[model samples]
Target: MSDQKTGGFIATAITSIAHFLTEARKQPALSEEAGYGASPNLPKPKPTLIPIMKIAPAVGWPEGKKPTPAKGFAVEAFASKLDHPRWVYELPNGDILVAESNGPARPPANWSFRWWAQDFVMARAGAGRPSADRITLLRDADGDGIAEIKLPFLENLHSPFGMALVGDQLYVANADALVRFPYVDGTTRIDAAPVKVCDLPSGRNHHWTKSLVANKDGSKLYVGVGSNSNVAEYGMEEEVNRAAILEIDRVTGVSRLFAGGLRNPVGVDWNPVSGELWTTVNERDEIGDDLVPDYMTSVKDGAFYGWPYCYFGQIVDERVRPPRPDLVAKSIKPDYALGSHTASLGLCFADDGRLHERFRGGVFIGQHGSWNRNPPSGYRVIFIPFTDGKPSGPPEEVLGDFRSTEGKALGRPVGVIIDKKGGLLVVDDVGDIVWRMRAV
Candidate 1:
């Protein structure tokens, strides 16, 4: 609910505490390893004082815009009129379900509690306003490339994100909770009221919510909770506020902490090869361009990636340092660092047997585009190739030219999934369109 900007006094205070903890935990290295003989791959230490970069708004695309040519794929419109579409899950019957996080009309500039309260009251009074959230079903009935929309399939949701279909049941992650609708073939209506699976903290506009994935056996579900404030606080209570991943039992609804210290893990997927969990995190903001790095990392149990303390793999954040000698020694660094402020969102492993063989087993990430840097970054989809369970190189642009030549953006991609026909389906919130990509 707090609309506090990043880098305010509260954020600075938290940063200071984190820095103190990191420094206090620094240990004296053995003589043999003290010299300039550290591993070559290790990142160099950064200075305490780093410059912060000012972020600019993105350029918007002209009306009726389309994607320019990319090397290996062609884009086709799948569906339109979607309101803030966040996630898309392909069902066994080749249908796709889309979840949208339509919320109270964009909060007023410099929002406050009083303004929000008034808005809520008006909304409840039926002030002739449109609904905030809903979900729908899309299908290509005749094997055509275009998808037809079936509206009102699921209605009256409190801004749901992260959807998955598991054998006769569809699970949705609503703001502050998880719900499931029983599946009935060829029908749009849910068989029964959604059964609550888990309760989470919601209502904050900045980090509303996103990304849910199930384990291979469907026994456990992983849900992402983004940070309440960027690098503001790290206390036990604050840590639980949308900064980690939650693992929940599918049947019992019991949930527990899966991983900690991710600023906003918007993109989460399971590595098909290793069965390990990987996430694309939107790192804390307000630091100069390139200070802290967003990452795609294999999340491990009880691992701490040092939000509000350290970032990327190892650079310590001085603002939030607070002398946690115990945590600094045990914090786990991320495996791969993407560029700062890419706003990475949804992630899925490429599994189709027909696309370029090079992309098989790689990861596809929807970079939602950056809002905290001078020149915006990540307005397209990129591929991270893996070989022998390791990254072969940096991400390559698989889809591009979603932004306008004048710096305006036409569409912002959030979620991605491989369709039944071995093509890729991408959800675009800005243009309210879902695009299907296949080899030409």
Candidate 2:
């Protein structure tokens, strides 16, 4: 952007700070109790012009410290001192790729007051850094928890987040589009120019990260695209082909919307037993802290889960003008609630069962945590039990204590995946650490 835009954002940031101080918003009416399991109790919608602002400032962890894992498990820094490590992917050859990135500057977003406020919040949360625009490879050649080899795998990219390998080709999901490059087994670095797969919605990218997953046969790709605005406050036209997952044809490079109204779907994974696609979605905010619950659910093709119009089934959000009852009626309820503003992002299935038996055959969720709710939620990794391919019970905290006693954020969990040794790898964006969890 321009200097004028930057000045305007600064002004808006000041106004947001003043508004937050002046407005004593309503506290959470219900605990996270109403938000969890297969069927959560949806409370009444509490709309507001000013959202509750409670940001946990990001503070780097002290030396020789790490996250606290649950019982029967151990946690250690798999990789550390990286620049904004956001997402991780494990290759078949036991190599791990970490996408060290941040959002790109969008000129259109700089003009909006909402964008200014959000930009201020992200800066406080240590997410306002310039994009590193690269992926680094980490190798635990000795089977130790720590990576023994670190190499610059792929560099000079645009806000890349997700990766998928199909045979000799590797696909990358950037903020604005999808691209592919040829891959060779055991190759440490890729310097080749990528083939442009397709152009994704690249507007004032409020939600920048695009997650990718390939079908079993590697013939198709599933990419998660998030909403352009909080709840279409910038008009519905700006949200076209967003807040959903898209299916891309591998050969033709053509893409189509697979699911809609997901708000901010982040992590995409395939269920081992059910053979179905599942995603963790961050629900809409600005309503009461307890209104709309973030969720994880098995996705169906062409299904709408309600964005600006409704949520958690037919609960309507009155703020959206010219309501679409037709779409709301068709909106499908989610499978499980992850609590409002939890920022649940990373998702992976525990198909290998390397952890304790209690964690076997469940979903591991990396919650990046929240800033909009008082007594903030979601700063660690959680496990949700799944029986017969569906959510069976409430989530259990697998790793936690991301916040200090004074509420300073020590770390936040992001992308999660099982490494070659069946160890769980979690990306800590703010702390610049990748934590490895294994059975003790």
Q: Pick the candidate with the highest lDDT.
A: 2
After TM-score superposition, the amount by which residue 179's alpha carbon in candidate 2 deviates from its true location, in angstroms, is 0.5
Tens-digit lDDT string for candidate 1 (1-440): 35455325544554465445434545532221111111113334343232222222333335667665357678887888776677888878787888866544544563654334334323322221443467788878878778765666788787888887777788898876899988877776664788898787664444667568888889999998887666664344555646789888999998888887888998888787787899988886655444355678899987887776676545567667464545555678777766666777878887645566778888888877665343457788878888766667666778877776666667777798888787788888776778888887
Model 2 per-residue lDDT tens digits across residues 1-440: 99889877876666577456536545535664457776777667766666567788899798877889998889999998889999999988999999999999868636766776788789879898999999999998888789989889999999999899999999999998899989999999999998999988877998999999999999999999999988898899999889999999998999999999999999999999999999999998877777678899889998999997998887888888989999999999998889888899999998756666666679999999988776588998999898888888888898999988888899999999987687899999999999999987
Poorest 10 consecutive residues by lDDT, candidate 2: 20-29
lDDT of each: 0.69, 0.88
Worst lDDT 10-window in candidate 1? 31-40
Give lDDT for model 2.
0.88
Top TM-score prediction, candidate number: 2
Task: Give the Å shift of residue 375 in candidate 1.
Answer: 2.1
